[model samples]
Target: MNKEDLLKKYFRQSLSEEEEKEFTLLLESDHDFKALYEEYSNLNLAFKSHEAEELKAFLTSIDEQEGVKKIIWYKSSTFYYLVAAVLIIALCLPFLLKPSASSLYNEFYEVYPNVEQPVVRGSEETNTYNAFKAYEASNYSLATKAFEELLQTNSNPNYKFYFAMSLLNDGKFDQALNTLKDLEDLKFSYTDETLWYMSLILIKQEQPLKATSKLELLDKLGSSFKSKERKVLLQKLQDN
Candidate 1:
């Protein structure tokens, strides 16, 4: 990609590994590109601040004008400021609200917690059970390893789903997304659930529109399991 597109992707937190590496190299080796990026960053901050302060002043003035006679909100200068301020704030809301991808991930990502059938006491437990035990105990490192081992012998979709979760917990996001994407297309019982997690992954990657697309797909599929969560998350993402 060119320098402008690379900088835009970097600001949007959507750079791939190779793109990120190239962006870093440009910052280190190209003085003009580095200077341009710094200038743009500063300009963005200044614009955000200006919009916020203008919006706040307009809002405060509306409250203060509540008791004044012969001066309606729409009839005063505050109204003009309010209109301009709202437009600017709308354009800059994402930066102003500071929506955090990690915060959203932590809020919605829940562990499956248990396997379908509980192992009976005195029964011979296998590596699969051991993996579930590790996951239940929150030992994701060991759980991820055990999950990979399970996948080696059996291509159980359930095992693959849990393995994807383990990778997500371990912060292997790209790998986890890839696994979830494959699961989403498999028409398994978890295909809907896979779509939900994939949407969350997209949100965490700062790709809200992509996440919205996934949510729309889930809605079209009539996924009752995640319908409410999907709606709430989609609203929150779109709001920012």
Candidate 2:
């Protein structure tokens, strides 16, 4: 059988003993064939890993919100195969559709929530409060200034993170990326979040290859921050 047929059976786990020997020989002797096999193997593994993570997160969210016991559906082999098949198709459909990177960015990008400060009405006009208020209001230009001021004295990663986000929202892509890169090197609560935004900014800048690299690193680091969305975006980027 040709290498393509070999790969098909290999992914399906249906290669006969003789075919398996041929596959191994090709892998050992043909550099390009080995690379092709590795590429497909990695993509398959990524899809499976992404689906499993999504299922787990979904059940966990249901349990948290509804106070119900988590379903253990993943323990069943039949259910696993069904989910894998469905997700592979669902995930591949976007590539078949050939959506642009800009559309994908719009689909996936949302302003990070202000989990640090509550924007209460008629509250005291503290600098921190003002910064978060502007961010919540979508006045990114104002938020950027406020965050910059706060970072001057505080150097708080939280403030810097929001500052970077504000820059991103304000279309200051270079500055936002630089700030995020700095955050990536620091030990902070927002490392995954930082990587996530960095990838988004790269996408917005029409740098899909760079964005994919960031996404791949984020995936390798096993970040749960936007794990499902990240996997989908990563696959789409790869396809493009």
Candidate 3:
């Protein structure tokens, strides 16, 4: 294909794997193509700036013609600003709105820090307490090992939850999701929370459809603790 078509496909992320590889090779090796791409990038930015200025001028004209004197403060200037913001967002959507799964993960993922009381009352000696302490300190590797050792004999539901979180923090996404999958299936007290984390894992793995699916299930389950947050996340995924 021509440079124009290749660039268009690249921008749209519509190139096939092979085509993308070819494009990358050309971009790196061909000075002409590289310069063309840089030119295209600059032109893209310029076009966006020009369009934004035009949109702002149009909105300003409307506000001036309509006059803001009669409307309430809450409804007049606020409403017009809101309208302008929404229109600007809509106009810039194709270029500015990145709805990739990794973007979603970055926007939403947060580690569930240890909130458990030490299993042993005042001594910082026991394995369980040490595991909780490690987790609280964000020592995920130590926490994972300790949680794993504790679970070998205990099989405590809470232990599994913490283990999954530790694994997640350590970037063992698949293992963490496996443990969370078990928790979700059991419908345990932490099931909704499990689903929430599982969604985040899928998102980090670039599986937005799967992430959104899990979020939808969590929304249906409706945990009192996570209901509002879950709804907001679900809406965000759906909007994307």
Provide the global lDDT of candidate 2 against the true structure.
0.89
Count clashing residue pairs per candidate: 0, 0, 0
CA lDDT scores, all candidates in order = 0.84, 0.89, 0.84
Where does candidate 2 stray beyond 4 Å? 1-97, 121-123
**Displacement of the residue 67 alpha carbon in candidate 2, Å:** 78
Off by over 4 Å in 3: 1-96, 119-121
Which digits, one per residue and each the tens of the lDDT, describe model 3 over residues 1-240? Answer: 888899989888799998898899999999999999999989988999999999999999899766755456547778789889999999888747757677667777788866665544677678888889889888999999999999998888888999999999999999999999888888565777788899889878867789889888866665575666777777877787
Per-residue lDDT tens digits for candidate 2, residues 149-240, read: 99988989989999999999998989999999888877688888998898988887889988988888888888788999998898878887
Q: Give per-model TM-scores.
A: 0.57, 0.57, 0.56
RMSD (CA, Å), each prediction: 35.0, 31.9, 32.0
TM-score-better candidate, 1 vs 2: 1
Please report the candidate that would top lDDT against the real structure: 2
